[model samples]
Target chain A: MRPMPGNAAERGYALSEVSCDALLREFRKDFRIFAPVRLEGRGRFSDTDMVRYGEIRNFREMELREKSLFSPKEVLFPPSETLFHFAETGVREPSLLREDGKGLLVLLRACDIAGVDRLDAIFLGNGPEKDPYYEARRKRVVFALIECGPLGASRSGSFGSCFCVSMGTNRASGYALVLRPEDDGLSLFLEDPAFAAYLPPDAVRTSYAPSFPLEDPFPVRVPDPGDMSRAVREESLFSAAFWKDYDSRCIACGRCNTVCPTCSCFTTYDVTYEENASAGERRRVWAGCHVDRFTDMAGGHRFREKYGARMRFKTMHKIHDFHLRFGRHMCVGCGRCDDACPEYISFAACIDRVSRVVDAAASTGGDDHDAR
Target chain B: MPRDIVRKKITKNAYRITSKRAETCLRVRVPGGHLDACLLDVVRSIAERFGDGTVHLTTRQGFEIPGIPWERMAEVNKAVRPLLEALEVPLGVTFVDLDGGYPGAGTRNISACIGNRVCPFANYDTTALAGRIEAAVFPHDFHVKIAVTGCPNDCIKAHMQDFGIIGQAMVEQDASRCIGCEACAKNCLKRVTGAISMKNNRAVRDPRRCIGCGECVLVCPTGAWSRDPRKYFRMVILGRTGKKNPRMAATFLEWADEEVVLTVLRNCYAFIDAHIDRSLPKEHLGYIVDRAGWPAFREAVLQGVSLDPPLRVAETLEFSGYFYERDRVFR
Candidate 1:
């Protein structure tokens, strides 16, 4: 095992399943705990089940075996949010603030914690004005990092389409707590001192430093960020023929964007009540670049008309464009997009394809010509 | 030497009279067209040992082993006991004697299409439903043919049976989850009935046009469409292929539940018994229903059945088929 990083051993505590449940009950009083939960018979097909993020009150409710179909982003950024209500007198913003001022304790994997960091870049650090809606939820959230697997023996392939190691998102550091599921119970490493009060009084102390997966079971080759940036600067990758195949293959269902960990796009619209014409609410719903009407302007003009062009725009935003400004790629490689896609389009494979194009361009002396 | 053998008794005992004198064929009833692969060895052993080493896969999903001598009928009956015990006994089919093979062959094998266990389009398990029907009305001397199809596609040729139980999925749509991709709508328009259409960037399904094929549920990327867990069925009645009035089945019950289907099937036997011509050696179910007329047939079968609001009972049925006497029109 790797050495515990900086006093991690001092914070480690071993709790039996019984005590862990007790600790969860105590946490539930002040914080709404969210974790991946197995919803029976709620899958796309009949007699099937799906695992997604939901509110959980007990440790046993958490589904640790399978990777969630959707990322933990939904807890902070809901699918639909009513911005403000309009009336003859004035407009009033809905109070999304919790009544008890309770915080959100989310249990997620290391890759998802990294995904949240990328989301932070988009919502909070992108420009001068931070999104207030996202800031409201972000300020009251703390993470409990769930161990994906043992060091050097990750179950990434079992998770299907995961390539976090290649994207350098297999490890995370900002989480307040680390939960390692053991055969008998749970081994928790708490970073935040305040959270330690919630632990059971009789909880046994142990030397359990959380281990990050060293390698992905399903590994993909990712191009160097610098090489990707150079390819983008040349403007050759944008018009490359690699995206043309997706015109027919991709149905533009936007399922990839829906399940993406870092996709932060939203479209706002007003809904008027039937009884009162002017009295209704303004709502913001999650939108995707691949979806229709995502780029609609005032004059009925739109961008990325073709499905392949949308794919190109999304790929560049996730890998090259975001990195140019933020010093890192937007994708954390959780691979939920790869999982949720009904058309079986692999975003990881697309990244690898981008890597190949970058290498081909580099081999040809970095010319301005199209890589394809 | 020619032997004096009683033909009627042996025919009822699941043995067929072949053209070759003193030779017979043994009919093995495989309910729902599904069986344990290991049980095939029993069929193989009987063919190789007692009869000519050839097995005919019957249209009603059964095995007919030919070239067995009439004298060895007892042995064949003894050999087929294992099949009866395995396939019949577990399905709640009561047997008087374990050694006695199929007591009656007038009610043919309950056939079914491969269902949701494998096929994506199938709403429910057809084989299990077939088995359930077999348990309800089997071991009887009534000439009836029944088939179960997974969807409206009718891969099992259910339209040609006396009773066809076609599976239907009651789909529910969540507009909030819909991304207006039009995948389901376009697919429904091109392949299935044009039941779905885009309205204000959301899919609007017409219940009247929808056949409950579950194609929308299969194609929806955002899971806007889903099958209601409660299974519903559409039953078509009195279709047959014969010398007299061979006709395709017509709709009798739509959006019926499992209990309704099984009850109707059970009620059909009484309807057949009350109207069958006793003088004839055997009468097909369609001819009996035709003789009794549609109203009398419907009244008899729906005696105790409680028709729910959504469930529609056909007021009339017009069968489409050709007659042997209609050869003059063909000329």
Candidate 2:
């Protein structure tokens, strides 16, 4: 069911801290819950900590204040997944289900929920044949939407790099549960009727409505997908002088791709065991357009050698190309790429630049060369 | 009339007799080369009031106020009490008289590079370690020089000192997180030792060639390579610069934890006291180590110190320096 703010009173329930723990304990029997957790001293630098998604045992382990350095896409689409194992006889698919046959319950923010929809478009609805490896995991996954309130005591309207409101992804629906941290306990909106049975009988009925962030500290103007598509067809945006600056700036570290929730590109390879050369497993690993050798062919030839070309390819794919095929822009504007770029390249600024270029080209009757 | 200045007492008080007959210079010690900005007012007032209104930044990361009259040494010592209390007293250095200025000047100021507090390349806080070293070895007349560098880059010129403490990072990789991007491998090959190589779509590090510079950890995009929480250090010993011989230090200990480094450094003083040539007014630590062979020196310093499994002690030291004797240099 699509949960709306007006009808939240009909579905909302308040649970004490102990009751919430009890409810999670009950849910744990059938679902493996994943949420952002703090990993001490696991950051890129020394004496630093990073928050990333991991299988959480209880609510106390979840890091709710800060945005996770990585997205929850790894739960449904892992970094490396083995499709099947092959030997002299025949091929056998790896067991896709968990040992307990438990489903996946992910706690994420609204923008990431939107990001999951984009991933769905690519993996499940991109072409005639669905990706079997992704489908098996996708079918078992559900979401718990975490309320994006004023971030800690500082009450910063949004994370500095996020522009989810500008991209119209600040609000999301179709979550099994909606959780808001209250002073005494937790106020939950049980949107999916199936989840109400899992709640403790002691849960108190309450009138509560979760609010979505309407503004961001950093906002971007996303170009109209139709205008971007037309610009792509005319080849104006591809050859725009704006992309040349990235040649010197970007280090091609692929951090942006690895952190992106919607980036779904992968490359398949076969690995043979050292002991038995004939016994091997076919695996698919996440690939990024910015990384080296992404477009390498059989010969020595490669595409997008200059970092600028790779930036252009990624920008068009995120804003224009995928929108043409899927009826929605692939980017959810979570701005994780901005946060993760070591070179400090801002994807939000790039989107604004694309909007300017597209507007300039349209205003000049599609003959603008100095649009940048 | 000529001034009746007691040179030994004045020198011990951190006063330098300058070329001018009656003028002297006061050297202020700044451990770790890091100090509060408020302490600069004391230095500025002292220079303006006592000296020729000028201050020299010493090579050892200390402040040297020149052109001070020798007769005003007493007043200058009183003026510098604040500096002493701020920089030295807090580091556990005990002062006989807080108003008497520096108790000893033979051991130079412990210099350090901008460490993990500022530089991304640094593995640990060099300034903090330098302060600890200062606390352990200061207030003595050893005529020894020591420097701490954040990494193997040796930015503080630690190789030119009697004792050089270099930061080391124990880098480890998580194979599952690696995407075979080769960023770390490429950076290591180009800028550092080629310790990492890509094999089977993952980085395989050769620990033998790894200098523990942490370039792999710095350049990694996926954070597959990270520094171990426990800090380690590489100690290079007996490098010196003088008219007799000047050479870079060689590695004496590798993968030494903080306790081992501190104990070894503290024990070096006793080794020097036992073997120093008393005929001369003062002897550098390097010359004493040269007079006594490396084995004797090693034995003396390693007394009561336990070497952990990961710590590697040097089996032998081969010093590369030139003798100033004409017979040895003549072709």
Candidate 3:
């Protein structure tokens, strides 16, 4: 893979300028562009001004200023997707939806790309199961990187629970194209020469500058493994006040999971048509761990009976368990959960509290060490 | 066609699903979780015309109709127009413009504990109060959650809500008419908060510890410790759970009356309107308040509101019971 813009070699790295309108028209020839667009009212993401990834008609409709309220991952893994059509006789996969055309996802920020990487790890990596649905959709997606607000020392570079700089997810690689708006116009970084033929003859040369700074622009601290591993793995941290407190506070509304880019947990169901019992469809819909029935299993045993326990499991997985296997934190620190939660539960703040409590326990000679 | 309707998870009023192929689910917002039983037919119409003739009861005590096609959302909304119109509230009337679609789901349906209307331990009628609040705040585009519980038994889980309101009845004991039954003292110690005790054959309240839950007032058969005529509620602020720190709301106002609560709530909108970050997609009220320090927020919410004894605001709120400002170590 090529080094990110500033560090990459100039040869074959032709930086140019393209108006957003012309770029959208050019990209439409090759792939269907899914960009962030504002809806008339509260869309699926539920906020009035929410920006969500959707198939766009014009570049003017694209919302690029703020982070997408809903993740672009849905382009690959839909909220509710039909797996196949079934019948009394036999089952068969539905006609491939991608037959319309390949999809081009544009303006994905650093944390979002990181989110996609995590999704790839869970869905398409060297895992026991490779999701054919996600794999098929993922194969046709053309990734395009978009730079966030103009680089400046005056601002935090991130807003509202966003801590990508501290989470080490402020930068990403592996994109077919990069769009960074400058004082003049939208600067286009064309790394792949394969797309050079699509560019206009007037495309100008420009050098890429690092946006904001690679380091944290604010005081926000990222979750640390040191605070978690010792107290979470070695000690019974479940008994802490953190886990017990959320029982009443978490209403199990499941908005947090729906807004979360990394929350990939899903539940599959079969629905037979009423008109024709012989014909049916097996579908997978987004399921939230925070939901009370999410833990119900065979024989009536529930893994996470209480909301607090469910919250603990979710927090531990995002900050600890996933990291133990992937060597990286699962959370991209987008803070959409904070914006989405009606109860005002701040997942970003929970990471900090969990770290503090765990680190405190680690330093204070935890009780019942003999058991650990 | 509405230009930006992607017809994904939900439309304005309908929840779009992909089960058995694409479908739309209609959500019914019954304020205070209490609606006219006759409205069932409006639901029947929606279920028959737009849905698969089935309704799903939501945990929040509302109703959801399943299996309407995504394209038929407008028709579904049109069918439910009567039900939405029947609400008769100015907010509800304006909200019905979406035809029957949930008009900009900013204000959530208020959930309340059945109070003095039925329950014996209630300090006040929760359903009535929730309806009052719902009318005052609905159809707005600011995200604020309010839950009302009758007494400290907290069956409604008030502490978890953004603006958790628990009814409180200030106990005024008259020693002259004491029965010396020690009922108030015994109940206070056994079931209620230990804020009362028997002293000289009279129930004496520890003013400092009294959460004003009114258990003593309820058990006082001799009427020595009757509730003060003024209705009051304890207000908790901010509570939330998220990526960093999750916290139960801190007590903001005690012995607050309906006027104070309403004023504070209305003022909250003013504060939010003034401070919300337009650059971001959306901002939580708590986040906006956090940006403006608690003191500034306090001033903003309590601008014209007045308070007296038993209704005094904490000099400095220290939410030690759970997480908030001080609980988290991270930024």
**Full ranking by TM-score:** 2, 1, 3
How does model 1 fare in lDDT?
A: 0.84
lDDT agreement of model 3 with the native? 0.69
What DockQ does each prediction reach against the true complex?
Answer: 0.38, 0.57, 0.01
DockQ, Cα level, model 1: 0.38
Q: Please name the candidate that would achieve the greatest lDDT relative to the true structure.
A: 2
Better of 2 and 3 by lDDT: 2
Off by over 4 Å in 3: A1-18, A43-47, A97-103, A149-158, A182-185, A210-227, A368-372, B1-331
B-chain TM-score, every candidate? 0.96, 0.97, 0.85
Output the number of the DockQ-best candidate: 2
Cα lDDT of model 3 by residue, A120-178, tens digit: 88888747888888877777777777765434212422355676776777777877777
CA lDDT, candidate 3, residue A224: 69
A61: Cα error in model 2, Å: 3.2
Residue-wise C-alpha lDDT for candidate 2, range B1-331, written one tens digit per residue = 7679888888888898789987999999999999999999999999999999999998899999999998888899999999988898889999889888889998899999988888878888889999999999997787889999989999999888889999998988878777778888899899888999987677899988898998887777666788887889999998988888888888999999999999998999999999999999889888898899889999988888788667999999767887787877787
Model 1 over residues A97-216: C-alpha lDDT tens digits? 433368899999888898889889989998899987888889988899988765422453357577788889988887888887776568898887667778888678788777877776
